[model samples]
Target: VAKPVFMSCNDRQHSLAFGLPGMVERLNHLHIQYTDFDDLGVSHDTIRSKDIDVAMQLGKHANDQLYTFYSASPSGWLMELGWGNYEKPAAQEHYTGDIFGHAVEASGYGLDLEL
Candidate 1:
């Protein structure tokens, strides 16, 4: 994901983490404050096997199409992660951050919620 993972305090202080696929596992193993939300249907058994701390069970949101859960971050804040049915922009990028086809400029501050 190109987006940065963040934890904010009082709407001011923030901590950012950018990681790859197994970043969640690394965060858990390190006991760092971080949250992991799954969209795209992660295997519950797989998550459990990793012994990740689960703060909430799988559920849907009131104004979202996400199938997600919450995890307690080491920083004492809830880290929200999830996937949704929002249509991907008609643009593609390679794993090396190379743009392919057309590029779409996506902008938002908080979660990009569509209702």
Candidate 2:
């Protein structure tokens, strides 16, 4: 079984996102491989000691209230980790989509594999 380096349910308990260092360390420890890139799609090694970056970042959504991001796993699959999700059902009117955020920003490094 895979062990999570960090996880949380509510925004009050955890930060909106994980730091780069922690993500790198956890991915390395898990033997997962990923590639780092800038917004221009050029490879950028932000951390000199590590070779990984966030695959995608989907900001907090209005429906679930979850802030999530993705990282490329060794199997050529993206792994999503998120926090700040609603624990109890809050009474709210039905909505079709998120009010804001949750935009998709992919690294364009992974997502190519024969499955």
Candidate 3:
């Protein structure tokens, strides 16, 4: 099987949760889903088992139900899609800095990957 590049396991799962609406739109364009690991039940555990460089589990925390992107790497496209992996952009200065990738009562700011 071809291992995925340019995406983390969290990225995959988060994309599934957050990008559903946009994904559905894209689905119509291609018959086969580009969703690689889902059918094989290749979730977080499975992907991790494969020794793939998906994501590093620093620890666990909980959050409310919110969807946001993280700046996961030193690349441009994915960086543009997510928060930059180091510095918070001026536009996102309002982030509450919650460590858990969960939604809060006031905002939906999940996925607390450091840039």
Residues 55-96, candidate 2, lDDT per residue (tens digit)? Answer: 544455465565544555565444554445354334564445
What is the TM-score ranking, best to worst? 2, 1, 3
Candidate 1 on 12-80: residue-level lDDT in tens? 113243332334323311112213443224544455577755555555443323455444455533343
Candidate 2 residue runs with Cα over 4 Å from true position: 1-53, 88-96, 107-115
Clashing pairs in 2: none
Q: What TM-score would every model get versus the actual structure?
A: 0.34, 0.37, 0.24
In model 3, the runs with Cα more than 4 Å from the true position are 1-42, 56-93, 99-115
Score each candidate by Cα lDDT.
Answer: 0.36, 0.39, 0.27
How far residue 39's Cα lies from its native spot in candidate 3, in Å, is 8.8
Candidate 3 lDDT tens digits, 8-115? 243222232222222222211101122333432333344447653322232222221222222222221121122222322343334444465423221112222232
Work out how many backbone clashes candidate 1 has: 1
- Report the number of the highest-lDDT candidate: 2
lDDT of 3 at 51: 51
The all-Cα superposition gives candidate 3 an RMSD in Å to the true structure of 15.1
Give the per-residue Cα lDDT of candidate 1 at 87: 31
